[model samples]
Target: MMVEQVEVLVVGAGQAGIAMSEHLTRCAIPHLVVERSRIAERWRTGRWDALVANGPAWHDRFPGMEFAGDPEAFPGKEAVADYFVDYAAKIAAPIRCGVEVTAVRRNPNGAGFAVTTSAGDIVARHVVAATGPFQRPVIPQMVPHSAGLRQIHSADYRNPGQLPPGGVLVVGAGSSGAQIADELRQAGRQVVLSVGPHGRPPRRYRGRDFVWWLGVLNKWDAEAPPDTKHVTIAVSGAGGGKTVDFRRFAAEGITLVGRAEGFQDGVMHFAPDLAANLARGDADYLRVLDEADAWALRNGVALPTEPEARQIPPDPPCVTDPILSLDLAKEGITSILWATGYALDFGWLQLDAFDAKGRPRHQRGVSAEPGLYFLGLPWQARRGSAFIWGVWHDAKHVADHIAKLRGYLDYGAPAALEPL
Candidate 1:
């Protein structure tokens, strides 16, 4: 097999990779993007129906193109995947799909790097791990042994139809979990949503879409103040602007419960603070709203109008409705959907640069390892690192640095496509 030589080798060709590819290409850098599967494979394979991005259409788009839908509305998963495919082709990014990067390490001489892939080896002066946050699904061990009921992580779930007919229990109260529970209940399935400590705020307020707020506050601006603590808090937790529609979930007969604790003998256990947690989340949101309102008041900005507040309905039927104990098996929750979360797995890249947390130690996208860089990561910028609208800003910065380091022009033309 022949070796492939490039100045910069970008791994994972999703939103981040595609955006970075465009930046590199425009800057006239010699780079190649390698993806484990075809572009948007995760969105194509991992997502489910009725899966609209929790964010507004405008906020979920890549650089150069705006989302073609109503800016206030959310786009479904298919639309998102299609958008990415179009972005890739429009930019004419040079990406090799179906190429899995098995390992990555720094060049021993410290000038460049080497990557081992299923296709062949590639040596490059720079490596950018643009693999976004959802690299792998993490399931808690306590769930499997604690409950004898069926269990599936969020990754395996494509839609409510895939769930067991019995009372469907969704663990993890994040955006995905909340949305899944809402859908299950809408489908007439007995749904029980387990609310973890982390809660979500509403996407719309008083008929005003959430994106309106984000824009008014200049959350997307590149020159926004860094000390705005409230904006920081809201945007970081706004996973795709995903939040449960309490009124809809409650009206449709979905029960919100405490966090998933453990499962045993077909029993699932939950902890306390279900109501309190929800209230606290609501209060936090209201607090932020009040602050934003107050700022507008002080600065002569317009006041916010009141939308009908959707409160969590009272006394939805619980899995253990008649005051059962914390154990889930006793309540008869047959299947547990561990919607916990995703983790970024960079373990295969045996560079001794990451902290104990397995995150690459990088100043912005430039890692400590010379010629090794990363971009399109969550929180990579002051804002919008993980979202579609956010990654491009970071990508542009990283792409410039890579180009300067390689002394290449603006277009990403590889000096050689074959390995050195």
Candidate 2:
């Protein structure tokens, strides 16, 4: 068994790992980035073929690297993956692709960590888990074990043609669910979208992208409310900056059902709160808009009075009857797409740093475990911590922390080091 030693080890060569590596290299920190697959594997293989980034290119950039293409346009999944590859090469990040880390545990002397990868073992003074947030798909336990139906997670779904030729029942009304339903319906397949509590932000507000407004309002740094559950935001770039509102799905002949409850006797039960869910999403969206408007007015920022020409009007009430259950075989729903988001998996890491909810206990990227850190997690430090543009900030902090511990000045420090 080959063994190597480094000052730092960064797992997963995605956006987060690459960003962390850049900072580590800048700090003259000896680090190795290991990935189970090629860089940006999720963006390259996990997403659907027609899927485009929810945010435009300008907003979907890393530190020191902006999209060279049209800033207003949203790049497709492949294009985004290619961008990551290019960025990794441009930064000369030390990455070992196709090298999976099987296990990570503290060293016997409590000095650092020992990472056991498929290739060999690596000992590092610091370990940064930059594996990203979406480690595993969150499929509900309510889904039935049916031999007649095909089930696929959003991460595995590539295109409408991959599924069997029949109706599709999307089990979540998040961005992925909405976009997939629309795409499947456009491909001449019937689609039933299960509604859930979501936020339907406009594609563009006041003649500017909604993301730009978010940045202006400083929402990215705003603290999330206490006891807030993750709410999926309904927005998409599949149709080139299109709004994936549930109201429009009803008008487009897509069956809108309530949240999936459970499955029994070849029937899938659902909650009878379709209207309430839609109303909640609408209300949440309006609340955000109101907040943005108020902030703009208070700051004296001029916003366009009229809506953009590309903005589509919200469709009127279409789904009225409360769909309580769906007869899977009878309705000809041959496939189920579970777009219920994802959960973090750190089973490989033998540590007590996780909370009751299995989330790592961290302040920013610094974890409870010394010499350990996490990056690319939703709201890790700010609302955009997991985002391409936001991860850089957290990376810089983690790099500085590691450098300080090792008696090295922060990267790019002056020659004359001041007193600590």
TM-score for every candidate vs. truth? 0.85, 0.92
Q: What is the lDDT of candidate 1?
A: 0.70
**What are the clashing pairs of model 2?**
none
- Please write out the lDDT profile of model 1 over residues 1-420, one tens digit for every residue: 666777789999988899889989998887899999889887888876667776777666764887785776677777788888888989888999999999887665434677889998888777889888887898888754444567788888987767666777787766677767766766777777777555345566645565566666665554433233222121221233444544346656777777666655555567766665656676767765665666567788665566445444554444224222344544556677888877778876878778876777777777887777777656566556777867887888898887676665335863432343
Q: How many clashing pairs per prediction, in order?
A: 24, 0
Q: Which predicted model would earn the best lDDT?
A: 2
lDDT per residue for candidate 2 within 192-279, as digits (tens), equals 8888888888777777788887888788776664346778888887767976677677787898888888898888888888888888
Name model 1 segments beyond 4 Å from true: 145-147, 218-248, 299-304, 307-330, 407-420
Worst 10 residues of 1 by lDDT: 229-238
